[model samples]
Target: MRGGNQMSQLMKQAQKMQEDLAAAQEEVALMKAEATAGGGMVRLVMGAGHQVETLEINPDVVDPQDLEMLQDLLTAAFNDAASQLDQMTQERMAEVAGGGLGLPGF
Candidate 1:
């Protein structure tokens, strides 16, 4: 009987943890991160789901003769935005997991 009680308590704790994780994920989904490159010539905003939410390019940087440079700046901005979003998601998940919950990829 005591073992059964312990098992029930453990199950309750697990359910609560699951709920917390879901809440954290929902919060993260509403978060956003932004990054820039080429001294702000190119900018990117990323959603928590790693989706590009917005992109801005300075008109002064648009050069018909130097398209490759503009491409490089855009790529760098995108990379930075993606990295920031990834870090933010990881941090939020870690917090939800209480630093480490034996959960895979947490």
Candidate 2:
């Protein structure tokens, strides 16, 4: 019947979309973003899931007389990386949704 054929076609399209979304999620999870502060004395690396991957501190920046400065730089770098990660997730989700109903997950 015509209705049955249309339903089958729609199901196939849905399955394809699901597959594409899964691929996109996988790719996004692997993406990385970095943020630095204090003239690059502190660097923060983040993954798409907003997880901190690494923290690097330049030895030259470490001064016993200015430990507070180093701490501030580390804090700023981590905050920046977290904000950037949120932006990245939003962008990736938009790309995967392709302007669809904006579902929470795909």
Candidate 3:
């Protein structure tokens, strides 16, 4: 009977862990990270899921003759934003996982 009780307690612990992880994921899903490039010519905001939420390009940097420059700045900005988003998401998820799911067996 003692062994059966332990198993039951373990099952309950696992269920609680699952619930916490789900909640953490939800919070992470709504998180965002931001970055700038080309001396602030481009500003980008990226979601935790790697989605581009907002991208703002300074009008002065938009040159029709030198479109390549604009493209470069955009690329830099997006990569920076993506990197920030990745770091933020990883940190958030780590917070939930680092507790070892609060399970004694783990």
Best candidate according to lDDT? 1
Off by over 4 Å in 2: 99-106
Best by TM-score: 1
Ranking by lDDT: 1, 3, 2
Sort all candidates by TM-score, best to worst.
1, 3, 2
Each candidate's lDDT (Cα)?
0.86, 0.83, 0.84
Candidate 2 local lDDT, 5-103, one digit each (tens) = 878877776787788788878877888889999888888899866788898999999999999999899889988988887788778778767845334
Provide the TM-score for each candidate, comma-separated: 0.84, 0.77, 0.83
Deviation from native of the Cα of residue 82 in model 1, angstroms: 0.5
lDDT of 1 by residue, 1-106 (tens): 9999878877877888899999988988898889999999998998866788899999999999999999999899888888888888888988877834444785
Q: Candidate 3 at residue 71, lDDT?
A: 94
Residue 83 in candidate 3, Cα distance off native in Å = 1.4
lDDT of 2 at 6: 78
Each prediction's RMSD to truth: 3.1, 3.7, 2.2
Model 3 per-residue lDDT at 34: 84
TM-score of 3: 0.83
Residue 52 CA error for candidate 1 (Å)? 1.9
